[model samples]
Target chain A: MDTISDTLGRFGGVYLLPLALGAVAFILMGAPSSWVTLTIAGLAMGMMVFLMASGLSLVFGLMDVLNFGHSAFISFGAFVAASILAGLSGWLEGGWFLASAALALALLGSIAFGLAAGLFFETVIIRPVYRDHLRQILITMGALIVSEQLILAIWGGTPFTVARPTFLEGAWIIGDVSIEIYRVFAFVLGLSVFVGLMLLLNRTRIGLLIRAGVENREMVESLGFKINRLFIGVFMLGSALAALGGAMWAGYETLITPALGGEMMIVVFIVVIIGGLGSIEGTLLGAIIVGLTANYVGFLAPKLALASNMILMMAILMWRPSGLKPAVK
Target chain B: MNVLLSIRDMKTSIGQYHVLHGVTFDVREGGVFVLLGRNGAGKTTTLRSIMGLWQPSPASITFKGQNIAGMTTADIARLGIAYVPENMGIFGGLTVQENLILATTKGRFDQIRLRRIYELFPALEQFWSKQAWALSGGQKQMLAVARAIIEPRDLILVDEPTKGLAPSIVAAMGEAFREIALTTTILLVEQNFNFARSLGRDMAVIDDGHVVHRGTMADFAADSDLQGKLLGLSA
Candidate 1:
């Protein structure tokens, strides 16, 4: 058993699962252009999901806090960004540079608001329930409900339409396939965040400490580094990332409501679980699988689209109980 | 000799059960001080209380003349003390080098100190890049001690370093502890009588969360009746 596991673990590039699934879809559909379009869309959706789930995964891994109310940050970010963009409609209608700047400002506003909310949530709500999974789940879920209601009170029950910048609208034509420009942007941004996070975790001292803490927090503390402060920082960072994902997702859907984050909670949880609870690389792999499976299944059988993620998660868990690439400390 | 650490009536309770009841012992500077006890005799708890892993109150733990009874583990560690728990506390998923790197306060490796550690435990350098979990039992114990001494420390609290090890490894560990005692004060908890007697300059026998005996190791070793009465050893 050890030899088998060692061999399995030694295989480095384990991300080909999604590509293999895409190949299956391509063969079944027998339409190269349509397959290309769906694959890119799947990748874009995966990237957005990853932005939201990676934070939760890190928090859970490091602090062992199961934050059920992570969706609140997403909803807050979506509404905050949407509101800012709505106010900047004039600048968005101007030249490309002005529109791009306005979009950038909206993202900044959303992220800032998200950071504040995250700080509040972590200090006031999450701090008291550290290491208590049942309480954390109960309290965070309650907080989620209350925040959703607050969103309803502030934004009303109607869904707000989100407009993409003129420069980001329409699809880029490449041969027979045309990909949405917003999706391309989401992919690039998501990939950049992933790369940045990898560097931060692998190349930096804090990252080493965080990883060590996940393995043995008491030891890390005994080594003269306060793990609580690191945990608080992680909590805030996770919340900010969730919000950023929410803002991007709002633009992708072109619709925002109180349920924006709540609805994505299932997908976020599925991705995090499928990617092992704390492994960033695992989360990315899980997200891509979920995105690809959903799109491919949705195309093949629209009725199975919503259930595809659940089925995939169950199957992966059965194969690897700890998820793929369970983050090594 | 100056007293490096002095614990006075240290009391600690884990949840509703009181573990340490007025456990008091003084560790002198520049030698190994052994805390001996049978299983569930609160030797580990006493060491933990000193390291500030458990909250100790209505107790005074003075290290370098500063009361550290109520301090956090990190704060206590910053005062130049390191702890090696009974489990060795090795981050199994991390490489040997990474494990050692995490122990340093500056987050940068001190090449000179690291070289000293490597010279002390040559096996650490041999398995530097390997994951800690893959190491043998004796190697893991060495890694744990190596981690504690990664940075210059004034005092080290080691819990059962020779637990579950072969006799040869235990003898080697005793030799290492004696070498380390030349520069730093050590407070060790051990179940193995032979290993404990080899390096312990001062000894305290703890039973039921209280210190039952305290004296020089030479005096303690000379009394077989006291060892049988306090530690259930019929040497």
Candidate 2:
């Protein structure tokens, strides 16, 4: 019985479900070009969401800390990257080499600020609430509010436009399917990160310790490893990932606002919940589902785009109470 | 025999409930010291306190003459002590090999020690890449023991190696424990009187967070009436 369920779960959850969802949308639309465009857009969006959700899952899985204020790092990254890019707009319009260099500098700046913010958040805001889920939620929510206000104070309460680097401004027109270069970039970046994380987690000694620590913290400690320090490092890494996602997202949307992070929080939470709290693979799957659902539904029924993800989350939860791939259980 | 670890009047509290009260015992070097107690007799808590999982107040837990009462669990483990909790504390998500790999300080198993562990718990090697969650209960227990002895530690605290197992597995576990006792000192908490009596060199009967009896296991085994009075056993 256990083997049967395990086999079915692996088959259904990993492959059939995603393919079936995409096929349904393709059949409904009946336009191959439109389906291809939407699929690419959805995959790109999914990748970006995966970037943000992966960190939350890791921190929650390993440390059991529910950081509602994680979006603060996202907002900081967006704003920081936006400012750097805006300041270097002249260099961004120069040759391909200069344009790429400017973009790299902006991304690095965003990651640096994100790291600093994550260090401070984990040390000052999160350290006190370890193992206390209720306190973690309450305090992190409060921290989120304060962080949003701080962003408002620093960047002013107005929306700002973000321009893609000149090299990434156009689309690849293949017959009838138009693929935005930026979306492809986002997809490649997200895929690289996902692969990198997988290798880091599966191939390294620290990764083995992290997985073990997640399963049994005391056992890891009893083996003479400082799990607390490992958790702190994980938290920081998660924050950095969120920032990377935020920077990419700002360019994808071509806009930044004080509320950028706060707004993305809803989508991020939905992805994390749907993906299972700590499972990275689940997060990726969930993000893609959400991305596809949003684009497909938005095209079919403009009014339902906002509620589609919520409905999807509810349906997935009903089918799998612990989310699609619960890391703990 | 030289005393390797000594716990004197150790007191511990879990939340508002004080669990361990003035518990005292000594573990002689290179011998099996069985802590015999009934359920909730603070046997597990005593082992946890020794591993520094629970902070004991107004107490002295000395290991090799150093006071290590309130140290962190990792710090105590660094002093060459390993713990196998009652639940086996196996990482169910990880493979058997991965679990053992994580237990080593260098994150890689020593080939010599690995071979020795495999010789003792051959089932672990058979399921090297299998997730620990899939292992049977007895196999999991064996893996837990294998992890503790992966490195040559000075001392090991094992909680209930045969808590729930078939008679055959329990006998096998007893033999394994006996073999392990040849190399390192062990502080074991056990509810199985027969199994404990078979392998234990020294024994202590604890009740309600206090040590009621302390002597050689042979002496305890010889006195059936004392065993009945303390452990409610005729054996």
Candidate 3:
């Protein structure tokens, strides 16, 4: 097992996983244009999931908090962004600058809500259940259910259609392949966020504290920094990211419902688990693999597509129990 | 000499398991104060209690004339008390430089202190950018100790610093501790009697979560019969 894993590492390491998956899919599909389209879809989908999963992974890794309510941020973000876009529907029909302003406003709304809601959730819902896994799970799950019900009360049970601005409504066609502009946009947004996070984690003092806290919370506290305060900051940041992901996802899907949070929760968890809890890089890797697998399987074997993520998770866990890239302590 | 840290009837419990019943000792303000005992004799628990890692109420643990029991670990630490856990508590994912950077109050290093640390543990300076997990055991221990003293600390609680170290490395650690003691008081919880005795100014023996003997290291070393009675064959 070690030899196989070591060999895998030697061959460009785990980061090559998405590309490898894409290669296999390309070979299996045997249609260059279709493969190109699916691969782009996969990368875009992976980025959105990365946004959602990264924060949850950090919360799980550092604070040891099993936040089931995390998906609530995703759900609320979607609803909030969707509502704002619908309110500003006139802007979508206008020029690129106006459309972009509307989109930016909606995103800002989601991010703001995420930050505020996250603070409330961390202090009220999570702080009380620290270090107790059972309670953490139960309380967070309870929060998720309540948020879903709250969404129903506010947005109603009907599926709401999201209005994309004219700039993001069409696709870029080159030769036989067609790439949706929205997917490209999602991919860019996710990449930008990922890069920003990397810079923060690697270049900043707070980032150093966060990385160290993820590895050893006790040691971090022993070094004289209040970890609970850091916990609140991270929880807020994670919540905000999840919200941003949800907002983007709403735009991608074009339609969303109250079940949006519950639906995305499973994939978010799979990403966190397979990527290794508490590692941002691991979360991104896991998300890409999941995205590629889902898109490929959905086209190749539509019936088996839903179970693909679960199967992949089991396979990965059986091979490496702690995960592909666990934060080493 | 002033009592830098005074622990009176400090008891700690892990879940339903009561680890420390009533451990009491005082660390004077200077040099190494060794707390030695056999394995599972609650020495580590006593140190952990002082750091407020385990909060057992109704116990008085005073540090620098302030009672710190039941306070958060970070609060105790912010009061200039650093702790080096038995596991070293090195952030394996972080670089050696990053690990040291986390220990500083303002995330800025004093050049003189940093130079002194590099002099004491040259390996840390050599692997400044290397991730801590890749470091050897001795180097990791050096990083742990180095982290504890990265900034000026009033008192440092160290647990078993010489465990699993090579003989030469242990001697080097002894030398480092001796030099550190000139500036900061250290309450060391160790099982290695020879290493503990070499640098310890005052010493205490704990058995079943209670102090059995307390005096100067010289007096404890002179009585082999007392050492046998307290520490058994290991002494």
Cα lDDT of model 1 by residue, B67-118, tens digit: 9988999999999999999999998878899889888877678898888778
Ranked by lDDT from best down, the candidates are 3, 1, 2
Summarize candidate 2's per-residue lDDT along B1-235 as a digit string, tens digits.
8999998998999999999888988999997999998789899999888888888974479999899988889999999999999999998888999888887877777899889888888899899999999999999999999988998999999999898888888988888888899999989888988888888899999999899999999999999999899989875
| Model 2's DockQ score | 0.82
A-chain TM-score of every model: 0.96, 0.96, 0.98
Worst 10 residues of 2 chain B by lDDT: B51-60
Highest lDDT against the true fold, candidate: 3
Q: Candidate 2: what lDDT? A: 0.89
Query: Candidate 3, residues A1-329: lDDT per residue as tens digits?
Result: 57976987888788887888988998999999999999899999999999999999999999999999999999999999999999999997788888899999999999999999999999999998899999999999999999999999999999999988988878999999999999999999999999999999899998888998898898888888899899999999999999999999999999999999889999999999999989999999999899999999999999999999999999999987888889764
Please write out the lDDT profile of model 2 over residues A257-302, one tens digit for every residue.
8788888889999988988877788888889988889899999888
Each prediction's TM-score against the native?
0.96, 0.97, 0.98
Candidate 2: misplaced stretches above 4 Å? A1-13
DockQ of each: 0.71, 0.82, 0.86
